[model samples]
Target: MNSMTRIPLTQLDAREPKSSGPQQARLPSAADVPRARDTQFKDTHGRRFSYLRLSITDVCNFRCNYCLPDGYQCSDKTEPLTLEEIRQLAKTFAAHGTRKIRITGGEPVLRQDLPEIIATLKQTPGIETVALTTNGYKINQHIDNWKAAGLDQLNVSIDSLDPQVFQTITGHNRLHEILTGLDRALELGLSRVKVNAVLLKGHNGDQLNRFLDWVKTTPITLRFIELMETGQNPDYFAKNHLSGESIKQQLLANGWQQKIRSKDAGPAQEFDHPDYQGSIGLIMPYSNDFCSSCNRLRISALGKLHLCLFGEQGYDLRHLMKENKQTELESAIRHLLQDKKASHFLHDGNTGAIQHFAQIGG
Candidate 1:
C-alpha cells in the first residue's frame, strides 16, 4: 500500500474511476481469466493463486449483534505477530507466489503501532497490494498515522444509516460517528472506499435503496453483503438471510443498470451506476456461489492456514513458527493444496466457519 511502491489506491474497493473523462476499461471476470495447463505461478493449473487474506489480530472494539450476539462467550483478543514475524511470513508467501495481501482483523487499528506493521508488509517484495477491513469507528482518529504507515485502501462494515439500527446491529450507538469516519477516509485521498453492508431479511433490507442513493453522491463504493452461514449470526442466520438475487431485484427496482463485468477478484460482482459517481458492488457468495473460481487462502489468528473459509480443517503454522521448523510449514501448505475441497457446501447445509467470522479475518 506504500504510495511509493504501488499506486496506493484501494485494491479491494475500486469504486471510483481515476479519470473524470470516461470510465476505464472493465476488468476481466474469473471466467475470463485465461485457462492454461501450466499457468505462470506454478506447474499445476490450480493454485495459480496470487491472493492471500492475512488476519493480523482478532480484537475488536464493538461486539456486533450479527457477529457475536449478547452474552456471547468469545475468546480473548488474539495476540498480533511481531513486525519481524509478519515480514518473514509475507516474504515466505511471496516466494511461494503470492502477490496481493489484504490485512484484516476484528479491528486491526486496535493493534499497537499498526503503521509499523503495514510498513513492514509494504517493504516485503512481491506483495503488490496491502488493503484493510475496519469498522470505521476509530478510523478518523488514526487516518493520518494509517496513511503515513503505508495503509492503502479500506472496506468499512456499515449495516444501516439509521442511528438506532446501527446501534442495535453493532451493540453500540456510533452511527453518526461511523459516518463521520467514512467522510474522513474519503477526505484523506483514499481514492476508493467501499462500504460493506450486510443485509438481513427483515432488519435492514428496507434500507438498501436509501443507502445506495446516498452512496451515489460520494466517491465511496457501497456493496451489499448476504449474511453467510457462520455460527455467530443474528438468530443464527435465521433472521438475516437475504440472497444476491433479492439484492439485484432491489437494485433493478431502483433503476441501476449493469455497466459491464466486475474484476476477477473479491466476492462482490460490481455494477456501474448511470446516475451516481461511484458504482455498486453485490457480494452474493451465498447465493451466486463464486466458489468455483475461489482461490483464497486464510490464516487464523493462531497461525493455522485454511484452504477454504468454511472448511472445518486448518494446519497449524504456529507450532512450526514456535519450533523454528520452516520445512514443516511448507509441508503443511502443500498438504492443504493437495487435499483442498472442491467447494464449500455451506449455504443450505452447515457452514461451520471453524471459528466466528470476528475471530477470523473478514
Candidate 2:
C-alpha cells in the first residue's frame, strides 16, 4: 500500500475557535502518539499516517443483529462530546497532522446538529476531507443540509436488500428509506458513497453476490465486512459466521475475478472484479489481519479512546476533558495515540473476549 502524506491542511481564513485559547501548537512528530499502550501511529516499515476515523457518538439509531445487544445503553457516567469539544478534538488531531476526518456515530445521522458538527470540523486548519457514516435513517431528510454544510462523502450501512430479510436483520423496517438516502446522498454530489454490508454465515452471507450484482448498477463501492464479535449476539455469530477469506473465495467462485488493485492505505483491503463494472471490498479484521497497518484509533461516544478494537483497556480522556486541563488533555490524548495496540485481541467475533463496535467505533 502506498503511504499517504501526513500534513495538516492550513486554514487560510477561519473563525477563532469558541474554546477561546489556541489549541496546543502541535509538532509534526506528535501525530505518532499511540492510542494508549498497544498500537502505534506508524507501522513497522516506518510509514507516517494521516487518516483517522473519529466517532462523534456511540448511540446508533438502528439495532442491527450484529452491532448491539437488546438491552444496550449508552454509558450513563459519560456523554458524547459536545459540538465544541468534537471540533476541538478534530482541531487538535489536525494540528498533529490529521488530514482526512470521518465523523462516525451510533449512526451519525441521528445527531440532530450533525450538519453543524461537520461544519465545525471543516473549519479546522488541517482537515482535508470530512465524511460521515450512517444507517441512512435521516439521510433523506437532512442530506441536502449535510452536503451544504460541507460533508465530503458518506458510507451507508446496508446489510440486505430483501425487504423482509432487511427488516429481520436491521430490526427497523426501512430498506427503501436507506436506499433512497443512498441515492439522495449521491444525487446531492456526495460522490464517494460506499455501501458497507456486514457478511454473516447463515444470515445474509450467502446473498453477498446478489448484493454485489446490485451495486454494479451505480458507482457506489460495495464493501463486505466479515461479521465479528462486537455486540451481544454471540450465539447468532457463533453458529453462523464467515471469515473474510471465505467470502473472497465465494466471490471468486461466482466468476468474480480477483485482481488485487493498488490504492491508499485504508482499512478495506480492496480488490477489483475485472468482469464486473464496480469493485468489491473485503474488510477482514479476522482473515486478513491488517492490525499491523492499523493506524486508526477509536474514541467511544462516552469519550474513551480505544487503542485497538480488541483493546483490554483505554485511558479516560473524558476525565481530562471534563476537568479542563489544557496541557494534560493534549498530553493524555497524545499518549493514548502513542500507545495504540499493535495487535488486535482475537479473530473470534465474540463478546466476552472483544469489546463491541459501538464501544470502540466500527
Candidate 3:
C-alpha cells in the first residue's frame, strides 16, 4: 500500500537460518538478560507461559457474521475493568514472567484512552512487547498517537479485499478504512503488521488469489486462520469449516514452500512464496495439534483468567482485585497458571463453555 520497494521472496533466502552460523557458546555479560531460572509461570505439563492476551473491553463496532450474529446484544450488567486495574494486573503479570502482551477488545480502538493504556503497558518492566488486535476502523485516527505511546505491533482483521464481500462478512462497509490503517501503519515503522483473516467456506474463501495479489502489493504478512467452533456460531462453523491444511495445500500448489521451523512461531505455520517477499501463515487450532508448546494465557475484559481459549471455566481475578487482596490475588494467579490444562478440547469439535468471542475480547 505504501510506495516502497517490495522485495521479491525469491531474492530472500526461504530457508535462511536465524544466525549466520553456529558460534562458540558465550557467557552472558549483562545482567539485563532474563534467565530461565527466573521464569515464573509454568504448568504441570512443563509448558512455560510468556504471553498474555489482555482484553481491554468486550464492546466491538462490527457485527461479523461468524464472531457475532446479526442483532446480537451484549449485556451491560458488569462494568469493564478500569485503567488502574489493568495497570496493576500488567505489573503482576510482568513480575511473574510475562514477556509479551497483546491488548485486544471487541475492537480495542473503540477505547478513547487506548493511547494511555498502551503507554502504561509499555512502562511495565519485563514486558518486552505491547501489541493490539483491532478491526482497523478507528486505528488510522490514532495510529500516530499509539505509536508515540510505545505500541510495538498490530494484528488487523481483514477477511477480504473486495469491498462488497468484506461488507457482507463484517456487516460494515469500511474496508477502505482498514486499508488506510494498514498503509499508515506500514509507513509508521510498525515492522510486524499482520493481516489476520479467518478462513470460512463460501465466504471470502474464493479470495485466496486476491489475497495473494494484495500481499504482493504490500509489505505485510497475511495470516489465514481456521474458523474455530465458537459456540455462538455453531451453525456457521459446521457449514463453513475450512481447514488450514487445505489453505496450505492451495498455497503450495501455487509455488509456496513451507518455511523452516527452527524458531517457535506460536500458532501459525508460516510459508514463503518464491515470487513474493511477504509470507503467508496458517493457524490450525482445530485441524492441527498446537497446544503441546502453548505458552500463553488469556484475560477477559472482566478480569477472568482463561488458561485455554476453549476453556469452559475461568478463575475470577476481578473479585480479588476488588477485594484489595493483593497477596491472595498473586497466589491465585500462580495457582491458575500451574493448574492450566495441557490442551484445549477443540480437537473434539467441541466449543466448550465459551461461544461468544466478543465476551472474551476476541
- CA-lDDT, candidates in order: 0.66, 0.65, 0.76
| Residue-level lDDT for 297 in candidate 2 | 58
Question: Which tens-of-lDDT digit does each residue in 227-336 have in candidate 2?
Answer: 77643556777776777787777777876765553344666766666556667788887644476555565566655554556653343455444334544555655544
* Model 3, residue pairs in steric clash: 9-276
The runs of at least 3 residues in candidate 1 whose Cα sits more than 4 Å from the true structure, single-residue gaps closed, are: 1-47, 71-78, 232-234, 259-263, 321-328, 353-355
**TM-score against truth, every candidate:** 0.81, 0.80, 0.86
lDDT of 3: 0.76
* Candidates, ranked, lDDT: 3, 1, 2
> What tens-digit string does per-residue lDDT give for candidate 3 at 1-362?
00112222222221221222222222122232323565477778977778899988878888898887663476554666688888888887888788899999777888888999999999999999999998888777889999999999999999988999899989999999879988899999985899999998979878888999887868788999888887678788889988888888888888999887644348778888767868899989875468876878888877777777776344456755543655555666665554466677776666655667776765
Local accuracy of candidate 1 as per-residue lDDT tens digits, 1-362: 00111111122111111212222222223344343444223213353567778877766777776776653354454455666667667776776678777778767777876888788777888887777888886777887787777777788888888888887888878777778887887888864778888887767978876786786787788888877776445365776687878778767777778656534465667776677877788877765456655656777655756667776434445544533644445444554454465566665565644446756675
Q: For model 2, where is the 10-residue window of minimal lDDT? A: 11-20
lDDT of 2 at 98: 68
lDDT winner between 1 and 3, please give it.
Answer: 3
- Model 3 misplaced stretches (Cα beyond 4 Å): 1-38, 262-264, 322-326
Query: Count of backbone clashes for each model?
Result: 0, 24, 1
